[model samples]
Target chain A: MEVNHISKSFGSKHVLSDINLTFEDNKIYGLLGRNGAGKSTLLSIMTNRNFADNGEVKIDSEDVSDNDSKLGLMYLMSEVNLYADGWKLTQIMKDSESLYGGFDHQLADHLIQEFGLDVNQKFGKLSTGYNSIFKLILALCLPVRFVLLDEPVLGLDANHRELFYSELIQSYSDNPRTFIISTHLIEEVANIISDVIVLDQGRVILNQPVEDVLAKTHSVVGPQKDVEQYTKGLNVIGHDMMGTIRANYVYGDLDDRILPDTVQLSNFDLQKLFIFLTNQYEGSGKNENK
Target chain B: MEVNHISKSFGSKHVLSDINLTFEDNKIYGLLGRNGAGKSTLLSIMTNRNFADNGEVKIDSEDVSDNDSKLGLMYLMSEVNLYADGWKLTQIMKDSESLYGGFDHQLADHLIQEFGLDVNQKFGKLSTGYNSIFKLILALCLPVRFVLLDEPVLGLDANHRELFYSELIQSYSDNPRTFIISTHLIEEVANIISDVIVLDQGRVILNQPVEDVLAKTHSVVGPQKDVEQYTKGLNVIGHDMMGTIRANYVYGDLDDRILPDTVQLSNFDLQKLFIFLTNQYEGSGKNENK
Candidate 1:
């Protein structure tokens, strides 16, 4: 799947600006961004739910606009509940199965039982967590090659989130496919995703494998002077200060020979790196949220 | 503040069952539970937003029900937005200041700038994350002695959530008040909250200081036979088997002198303990979500 120079705007406010991305099969991708950072807008444009003002989204070199075959290949579970409020859980499942075709009824039944979701319950009556669970079940049971989940575990509790993640892993292992998860909960999905795509102010700021990203960035902490001296020539992305102590996030390898006993080096988690980078972008005040 | 044998029900479903707990000032408490586990119900009842079927809620030996003076000391920031849609962010703050009588406008302004919240925007126009931020700013700036935050970080991104937690610690340290946070994201709040309160099926299953709770529980992992033998006489809370290996969670101190070299002991995180305990209670089916 490819998003080719996509650009979108709400009146004069640009939501996505010249965004370009490529998603490969059988890989889990983490689409991370702050609130109103164009993560959802990009996903919606790719799925054809919303149109982009410029450029296009294509699958297998074929435009997805008004293309039934291309549309059938991907499924996007968004935050909005498209199912009717009066519909029963079973009814929704049945309708989705018929529309999507090849829906895994067995897996759906198993998940329903595992989550203790009653098929007889109406959609509107479900709690916030249960509502999210129902939508996730639909997304997982579908036999689409590309599955895009937006805040899949939005209202799930700790145990339920754990169960969902384990279930996702099991599903991926059994049948490999492309999974793009966009969420605010970073640490929970950090280890599971293979690739990281970070968007900041409608532009793709970072797109790399998780390992490669983590390998290049590290936090070096020590006395302020020592830390600054050590990271002077490195690509220092960000830094934190606490009195005489300092921690600098360097986006390059360190020379072992120059290492001192007073300093310590550790890799930055995806969440920390994300926070540091976006903080810089947000502070610039050029790309404000409309 | 104390809840004296509080009980609540929704028609035939018992939402809260004999919940009796106490809250002291100058402490941070984590009110954790599964979805539909009665955490919100307890908070609502304590804040006088919802009436209990039985018993009374008292603050300093004074009944809080319909008592304006006592209720004035407490504030509940719930998931549901209670402010008028037409009101602007600045308007709500001013209204809250008049009602609370000692609102810290300086801190409110500082946080608004830190979060980059637009005070001119109407309440209904804010995003999910911004809505939470607005309410959180109010909760922090208020001079109320007891602050009850229900899902305070519901829609916040990673950076925003981190910022909120740090700001909360700063406010708590400066003012020294009681903060009871009800949330499903356990790991995020584990380090900040001093006490843990686990609600299961409308019951207070566990309520203890974090240090005491963690000290009593540990995970022992090793060969299946070795783990089983080691935990035979101990209070085994939970266990997991993986082929020839096993992991057992014991809720009592171990005699390190008698432990075999193959056996490894590790501490259980608050999330893991909460999951294990709640899983057991939920599987019993006696406290089902209605």
Candidate 2:
């Protein structure tokens, strides 16, 4: 799946403007941005459920909007309304079996039982976590080449969320499908995302491999004086100054000799990195919510 | 604030059974659990909005239900009718002032501008992030002893989340209050939490300081053979074997002599830790959404 030169707006408001990016093969790509950055709009357009004012979205180098084969290539926005509130979840699975070619009935059943979602209960009666599990099962079991999840685990508990990530990785390994996930919880998904496409005010700001992204973004913690001096020439991403303990994120390489042994170093906090980058580029002038 | 042997059941299903916990003053507490673990239900009971089938929730050594000052405690859920749709937010603020004492007018005004929330706009017309900011502002501006935030950053983008945390800390410093925040994005808020309480099946499983939890939980990476042997005596929190690097979340202070310099050591993933801990107590059955 891929999109190029996409520009969309509502009235005078430029929600998404001049966006160009590609979602390659079977890798997990993060579709991230601030509210009103047009993430939903862009996904809506790609899925052909909504149309874009301009730009092209293609699946397997073919226009997805008009092709039925490619139509089966995607699924998006999980607001489970299978027929009616009276419908049982098992009946919903039967419907799924008819819609998608790669539907795995056995796997779906196993997952249903795993999530403790009662097969006998009506879909409406299930708890929110069970509801999220239901969506996750269908998405994983159904045979789709490209899957898009937007806030998929809204109501999930800690246990269910863990299950979601494990199943997601398993699904990818077993089926080799492309997943485009949009989420506010960056740290949880950071380990899984092969690539990240950061959107700012409806424009694609950064699109790169997650490893490279992390390698370029580094955080160091040590005595306040050492941290400040070491980060002077580098692109200082963020700084948390609490008394003498100053933890900072810098976008640059470090020489071994200059790196002090007393300083404790760790990988960047993706959540903090995301926040600082978005703010540094778009956070200024805005009255600090802090 | 504290609860003694609370239990609430709906019809035949048991929502919460034999639950007892305490919330300390002038500190941040995390109320964590799966979606249906009665987190909301428990919060409702403590706030005096709902009645528990058994047990008592106390506020300041008195039953929560009888105290008029309980109104000072703010409970903000993701989905609720804070104000009627057509009413302007400014009017709602005026109304809020009457409902709660010690409301800060200055902070409210600053929050409105900081988050780009239009005070004159109708309440329901606002975007999700904007709505979150507005509600957050109202909760923080209230001169209250206790504040409860349920998925507070619902529609907020990455940048706004950091801002929200900063604002939260700043407010707490200005006026010491007890905060109980329930969220699934554990890693994002892990640093800010003074104490964490993990609930599963409506029971508290692991509750401790952040440093204590993280210290006892560290990841060991190497060949699966050595990794498994090295972690035999330790409580295994999580493990991931991918080709060459086999990582395990070992619970113990690992001896460096046994680990050797060749094996790569990594910090524990908190999100993964929450998942594993909950799964151990309960199960990781998939939520089978068809």
lDDT of 1 by residue, B211-276 (tens): 999998889999988888888888787777666778888876776547889999999888888888
Q: What would the per-residue lDDT of candidate 1 be over residues A132-174, giving only the tens digit for each residue?
A: 9999998999989999999999889998898899889888998
Model 1 chain B weakest lDDT span, ten residues long: B281-290
Please report, in order, the local distance difference test score of every candidate based on alpha carbons: 0.88, 0.77
Each model's chain A TM-score: 0.94, 0.87
Q: Please give the lDDT score at residue A167 for candidate 1.
A: 87
Per-prediction TM-score, please?
0.95, 0.84
Deviating ranges (above 4 Å) for candidate 2: A77-85, A120-127, A218-269, A280-290, B70-78, B210-273, B280-290
Where's the lowest-lDDT run of ten residues in candidate 2 chain A? A281-290
Give Cα distance to truth, residue B9, candidate 2, Å.
1.5
lDDT of 2 at B260: 54
Per-residue CA lDDT of model 2 for B1-290, tens digit only, reads 88899998899888888888888888898877766667888877777777899998787777877677764565555456658899998888888888885679887877666677778889989887888888898889977778888888877877788778877887788788888898877877887888888777778887887778788777888877787777777877666657666777776676654775556777775666787777743322222221
Give the CAPRI class of candidate 2: acceptable
Output the chain A TM-score of model 1.
0.94
